[model samples]
Target: MPGQLQIAVLPSTNPRLGIVFALYPSTELSSPEVASMGMTLPSVPRTHELPPVPPDAPFIARERLLSLDVFRGLTVAGMLLVNNPGTWSHIFPPLEHAEWNGWTPTDLIFPFFLFIAGITTHLSLSSRRARGDSERAIRDQIIRRGALIFLFGFLVNGFPYFAWANVAGIPDPTFLQRVLDRLMHWRIMGVLQRIGIAYMVAALLTRKTTLRQQVVILASLLFGYWIVMTALPVPGEGTIGALLLDRAPRTMEAWVDRVVLDWTRFGMGNHIWVGGVTWDPEGILSTIPAIATAMLGNLAGRWIGQRRPLTERLSGLFAGGALAMMIGLMWNWVFPINKSLWTSSYVVFTAGLACISLATIMWIVDFQKVRGWTRPAVIYGVNPIVAFVGSGVMARCIYSIIKVPYDGKRVAIQSAIYQAGYASWLSPRLASLAFALSFVLLWYVILSLLHKRGIILKV
Candidate 1:
């Protein structure tokens, strides 16, 4: 393959010369001319040159902006912070999701991740198309990546599969009871699970769909969800939840959640979701509406990539985002902005926020040329999947699987740190947050090394 393709390059002294030697683009030298006693042969493009995009960023194409990577890196950072509390016993209200009917900063995390994923899908597919990749190849690639992500989520959620903590078939509880307790405690739906489903369906649906078609589909999903939720009677509560839900279409998505993705545990305030373990926040039914959030992101990415002025692109995102946010608020009177079920109003509202956030990033990084804080984020962004998976697995193994007996107690290394430094001296919340931040820094350092070495692990 290297021999067949023409590789583009430039002469530069880069630190990662070893990788460049192996993976550099292949370029054919022009027919060689005889050298004279005092003359040297013409210099061919150097094999060590990078793509034309700045060395500081990674995008679908080298010349494209790096806002998407920034978005993704920030998101991964947020996920690590939220997931890795020093102690579960002490958490700030902001770090926790709202009690089913309100919004919080933490609620924005999932939507932000999904929204970025959508934008990335658009940029990547478009770049591939520009390079004349066949539609079939793109489809297959999407399917494979989507499946792998979903499986990864499932594996993470099912870590240890059987509880090693329950070794020796302890008789304090029946063996069956032990396993059942684990299942009961297991959180079935989570961040990556949602990403998997959303990417698979959204990518297939949007892969070949026209912009007009996408708008139509998006509008129809929002409104159609509205109608079903308000009109249809919930199974257990009848129309109480539907009517009390206050939002027309938002209830539709929740109703779907209650009907299909039941199997939830007791939620906040001891209030059960009322469908007998059905209606998870990250359940199957609400995911339908989640796709629209990704669509909103795709639309922004498409607009940004157009050859329009940078100001025009940013303004368009702000304008569209404002409109969506207003519409969401207007609809919220009938359908509350609930994150657990991902109501249509919530979807619109969050997507608007996502759009505004992304536009601001583009305005500063790409437009104003401010790049002071971009290097760390850009490093995290280069190999997003690797960073996320590696960080998650490493954190889990250290915190849970590895145990050290200290002070006559069997404690994980993470717990030992908290016990000694946090519970003993500092406030739990601060300690927990510190641990989370430390986790992020650890991953960031690893990613920095990868970035410096030009090790982009794209799968």
Candidate 2:
């Protein structure tokens, strides 16, 4: 707060006297107050002589970085595009996740989101602390926000609240049975759920710690995960974790998911990922590295928030990102850059890329003053939760919840529409890509309207 305040002096109308102006941040000084005092706010391009205001004015808010929002928007848009293909089987190579032990462009979307969340979490906490918010209040807020996001993700996983018995060629069941089925099969881990967990853990870890302390904790997490994942032998697998890296069922992360989430033994097991049933991409053990990923972003946020020149900050990002990438590549020989596992090497590599990507955006949008092409991404970025949750619900409705008459019997509305509108006119891969793009464009329009109305769906 002290660093943000600036003071200036100018000659008054009398010319013999000089008036001192204390430029409280625009957040602390309202426009009307600035006008009444005959001063220009920081955001305004004009200058004026003004009476000095008290330096201890209460903190109100801080300016957000446009580059951050644009980055987040692009990530959210990419998530929508990747998640809503016309047909999952027809996706391009870059759009689909790697089958195992490697990554693609699609894999980066989730980690980028987590990284952005870490940066925003830092900014938000700093603003609150500046406002004299108590530690108790901040912790409660973190817990509450993280819980709500997790619950929302859970609901999204079981959206429409109905069983697809009829769609799956089974006889329709009673409403009670449908409800029970949904609860039984509801996924326990997902993108937003992992995000909520990572956000909460990373925030609390960084809350009362110094930079050196945080870096130590971060290194411990990465190394601890590596030690357990590679050095330790997985229980019952009769082999070391390194030997089981290629087998999803045998990996320590997947084994934990099966044990803790298995409803048969633990009463929560039925909630495992529907994709694999036995393992999940966002499973429990893997979340450790995910937390490290968020912490990495938090560290980057601290660096960005320093009172340093823009060029210096940009240079640091480039150099640090390069260093991290090199480290990740070296470690990948042992751990492998596996997104599903959220491996340590994967965390370092992806976070490095995140840093460099963000720095590039900052240079283009923040330093270079280029503004015209940023509008669409900004709209999606500002209302990320809206785009994510809304698109998710809409996707579920079309893909599974609704049915339409097809060539012989009924089919999911999504399939019906895709076959008739897109696949009918283009190659399978092209149709899939086109459908995904349409989904992105549709959300852009929706988010654009929300932006115009000054609506941002925050969690």
Candidate 3:
């Protein structure tokens, strides 16, 4: 890693600049160290306009739009794939969550999505600024995008608004109580909701403030989260981090979620959760630092859009990412990087990975011009929502209402499919992965049609 750090690093110019490309020595950068930095090498181009490639980026999808789309698509794909496994009974290590602390590939999905969001936001806003779009317009766009995303999340959660039946076939709760419970049990703060809020806040912050100011905001939010999680005494002193884990009263996020979230939906408090605070993973206060995740991404986006050489931009991103990650890791020794908490360390770790990943994509798509292998991913990348929605609809239909006919009993379609194809040929892990990919392809066909027809269902 030390040797890699010396592999022709470059400094980034100030915030408001343009893009460039430069050649440099190859280097190998990986993990805890990787977490600390903007990103590690493996180059990709930012624009379609660039020099011919001699040493292309390996495994990275080239094509600026495609890179972003794929990163986004991958995130969406990952969410669906992870959320929809053939059998939770036997999941691959990468698909599982960390026990108490530590991370796996699954943990990277959310932050990676957020990272791409930040990158896309920065790139889009910068271009608009260049095209004479007023600051007011850009701000308006951000707000609009944010609001729409928020609305969509709410709508999605609100769908199929009925729970499993009670005794005598009666519904467990009344509509009013259910609605109230949405806030009470509504599982307040979720994947899309977080994305919406984070995007809006981060966009405004980035657009309105200076880069230095943005950096300050990022640090403050992360530090603030750490302070609150640790310094605040548990209300009545049961357990420290526990209060922040579930629907506990002392936790600031739970209180806010109770007020702001759909009570009927997210309010159960985990079955045995006993945290003093009961923090919803996507609860209100937690979103503050989530904005920092996007900010780092925007900075990277701004840097990628800069006029410096491609190598230079990649170098700077890696350096800055490295520094942030290092700072986060050191902080983790004290605060710990808890994704559920969205702690400062988590931010640092995720943000560093984001930069490094983006740099790799830039190297491949933009620099190397080798996009052949990325076609399948690119297909999935084009329409993320289609993939998400299709998976959602299909899963519910097959796994629930549309049962498969089996030995005199109704069987889940998913189970039947797995038994017929996946089980028959591949190993469980391979079978599960294959199902996930096929699921992606099923949606890809629809998205490809939409893309061909220019019918994007934008938020």
Clash totals, every prediction: 13, 4, 56
Give the best candidate by lDDT.
2
TM-score winner? 2
TM-scores, all candidates, are 0.78, 0.86, 0.75
lDDT rank order: 2, 1, 3
Per-residue lDDT over 9-50 for candidate 3, one digit per residue giving the tens place of the 0 to 100 score? 222332101111100101122221111122212223344223
Whole-model lDDT, model 2: 0.74
Q: After superposition, how far is residue 132 of candidate 2 from its true place, in Å?
A: 1.5
RMSD of each: 9.2, 8.8, 11.4
The lowest-lDDT stretch of 10 consecutive residues in candidate 1 is: 32-41
TM-score rank order: 2, 1, 3
Alpha-carbon lDDT, every model: 0.64, 0.74, 0.59
Kindly report the root-mean-square deviation of model 1 from the true structure over all alpha carbons: 9.2
| Candidate 2 colliding pairs | 261-269, 262-269, 263-269, 263-270
Q: What lDDT is reached at residue 410 by model 1?
A: 90
> In candidate 1, how many Å is residue 118 off?
1.3
Model 3 TM-score relative to the real fold: 0.75
